[model samples]
Target: MDESNNNIKEPEKRAFLKGAGLSIAALLVGGLSIERYAVPKDRSVPVMDNFPLAILEDPSGQPVTTSEVIEFAGAKTTTTSSPILVFNYPLQDEPTFLIALKGVKITTPNTPPSSGFAPVPSGTDAPMDGIIYDSTTNTSILAVSGICQHLGCVPPFLDYHPGQSVPFESELIGYKLNGAGVKKWPDYGLIYCKCHGSQYNPVWGGRNLYNNGPAASPAKHSLPQIMLATDSNGYIYAYGINSSNAVIRTHLNFPGGETYGSGVKSEDLTGGTAIRQSTRSLPANLSLYKNTTLESVAPSSLGTNQSSGAIILYKTTVVSNENKNGLNWKGTF
Candidate 1:
């Protein structure tokens, strides 16, 4: 019985040795496979995105300036679109406007929002980059390119907010208060990009203050401004290139044809309306708090007869104000 047990143990040991030799052979042959299954240390992935203010090579081989002659129906004058239009006034030697023909539209390149840059749109073209100046009013003029700053999608002038539109909210991150000092849902303005719910401020430079979009976001940027131009003869032209580049002489033609509108005169803008109100706001009140008693502290009774409160309201009968961006207030308390 002992001899038989020994014989069984010898066979078991031989089987174990065979299995171990096969395992070692497999390990040497499959070493690369083990490494292939190893976990990766860097998990970061890159994404492709568009940028606003992307410096395109000024439209490859395209003329920096162009000229075109078009006749508007019922108008006796013929307007010539030209780069020379930028220097309409002797004092203003640069173009400050871009005019689109009646139905024609212009697009800008893709740009990041935080960078205040937006992707320029495709399919729209202007003989000259949109930049213009108005000699008649002594004021500069510019128009928005139809493209959205959030994505390359062009925004429409919808009567109401689009379903997917991005509403402009505060950048303060937390809940915001309203003008009434009541804590309210954050809502500032309507600058919705429906494709991805990115909201912007339309009145100010197109600023992306809210985000509800893809991982790729806009940088700290604003919409690239398209400049417009007006010649001495009142011809309006638009181009994307800056006015400082060496002049390229070509007749800038509007492929979609030209549109025309008589600019509103300064007097016409005011409609000769009578000055019924003032445009002056009072200075802020600066009164220190007073300690009335051991148990009572009162707000300074000092107040502005003109305006007072958390926000100072002001009204004035103004004869004139030289400051262009100054606040013009009117009210009676």
Candidate 2:
């Protein structure tokens, strides 16, 4: 009886061990499934969508023609200033910089050098054709997001530095005329950010033009270029954003969970109330301060439905730049 009992107990122990092993294996498989489906893959490509085409409008609510942009840019350039026109597209709250590169024909093969950070979405590594409208002269008109990629800073802080005219911040940060300094600055003016000194070369598809300075660019991506088209009537229209890998600043163009929506980036257009027309043009020579205010004016005042605002311009008074310590400055209205 004892021998029989031992034999039965041995078999029972083997069967129990086998069942436990199978249960553990099942749990391991289940855990893997959850992990695979729950968490998104890192650096997953953003879902690309074509935003609705918007007509480019002036402050007067009229269709802005290419010829007009060129003419305005020429007028500004004659005074050693660059035109920085602000308009909203694809979304009401998102402002874009509509600029014309005077005496420079922006052509194809303007692909920016890879920074080796963000994964370049397929088919976007090339130049965006038909976006740059040839003005029948050296001028070429294009548009880009006004928001800085380093931080979400807007106009006046991220305005263009035209030709040889360097911003005080740009000068301190080592940008020089004709690329004369240790770090070469482009001959054409860059889109400079005074907030943190980040710079973008608009000629090179708004690529980040990093400089050697204490306040180097903290941004990793280039400015998203706005796609443009022109009708036979010479009217320019903003159709969509360039389907490039460079994501728009502050638009939540990241991977993983859906903030805007699952795999829907164009839905970002839904949140902000659309700006009806361009804001008043600010001159490049005016001294800009962090405390400068935008006083809103009634739509009726502008003779349009667009709510307009004016930036109070100031002149800079530099006290000293002794010892190359940076400019000691004050603003006077």
Give the winner by lDDT.
2
Report the Cα RMSD per candidate.
Answer: 33.2, 23.3
Q: What is the TM-score of each predicted model, taking all chains together? A: 0.24, 0.56
The Cα error of candidate 2 at residue 332, in Å, is 19
Clashes within 3 Å, all models in order: 56, 1
What are the per-residue Cα lDDT tens digits for candidate 1 across 1-333? 011211111110111122223323434564222111211121121110100111111112111221221111112122211111111100011111122121112222233234322222233332223322222322222333322333222222111131122234222332233345322332222333333333443222212233432223241233333333332333332222222221111101212211112110000101111111112222222211112111111112222111123222211111111111121211110
- Highest TM-score against the true fold, candidate: 2
> Which window of 10 residues has the lowest lDDT sum in candidate 1?
264-273
